[model samples]
Target: MSDYLEMSLEQLQKEHAELLAFNEKLDRERNGYRKYAMKYAKKVQMIESLFVVPSDDHELTIKAIKTIVERVGES
Candidate 1:
């Protein structure tokens, strides 16, 4: 007789296998995001290279550039 709060042996094994598979998929997705983050950082650096700040409003230009860089992923 199975206890009310206990899973059957087969069900328990199947759930364990499913959870393992899900965790593996999550790991792969995490790695992909890591790669993408690196790529995004490089792209931000490249774009920043093209930015020109006038001597008169250097601080304003810097603020604008920072905003643009932070918003790269939204577009």
Candidate 2:
């Protein structure tokens, strides 16, 4: 009877160990998605800088800004 109870306990522990390992794999996949999202966000920020005015082109900068606003509004 003692041996039977010990075997049952060992089986339960093994199943629990498998579940913990699967959870870790899922956590890793979720972190990978978060890293990709951060990369995309950085790219968007770089692209948005095209709308900023440099010191040399006052009129052209105004026009570019207007065009950017219009395009953004259309989207």
Candidate 3:
């Protein structure tokens, strides 16, 4: 009975250590993913939310078209 009790205590200690390590790893991974998501979200807002589009004036549109054509030709 004493031997069985000792074995159980040892197994429980090992399990506790494993659980603590796993919890720390999960926390780090979650924080990394959250940081990456925030960065991606910032870029998405700039491009996808129409936040940086040019003005709708006719003169500006023409100039923009010319600039695009020039760049395309260069490419």
Every candidate's lDDT: 0.75, 0.68, 0.65
Residues 1-75, candidate 3, lDDT per residue (tens digit)? 235455677787887798899999999999989987776665545444342665667676566555554553232
Looking at candidate 3, the ten consecutive residues that score lowest on lDDT are: 66-75
Q: Pick the candidate with the highest lDDT.
A: 1
Per-residue lDDT of model 1, residues 1-75, tens digit only: 445358978887877798899999999999989988976887677566656433577787677677767776655
Could you give candidate 2's per-residue lDDT for residues 13-42 as a string of tens digits? 887798899999999999989887776665
Best by TM-score: 3
What clash pairs does model 3 have?
none
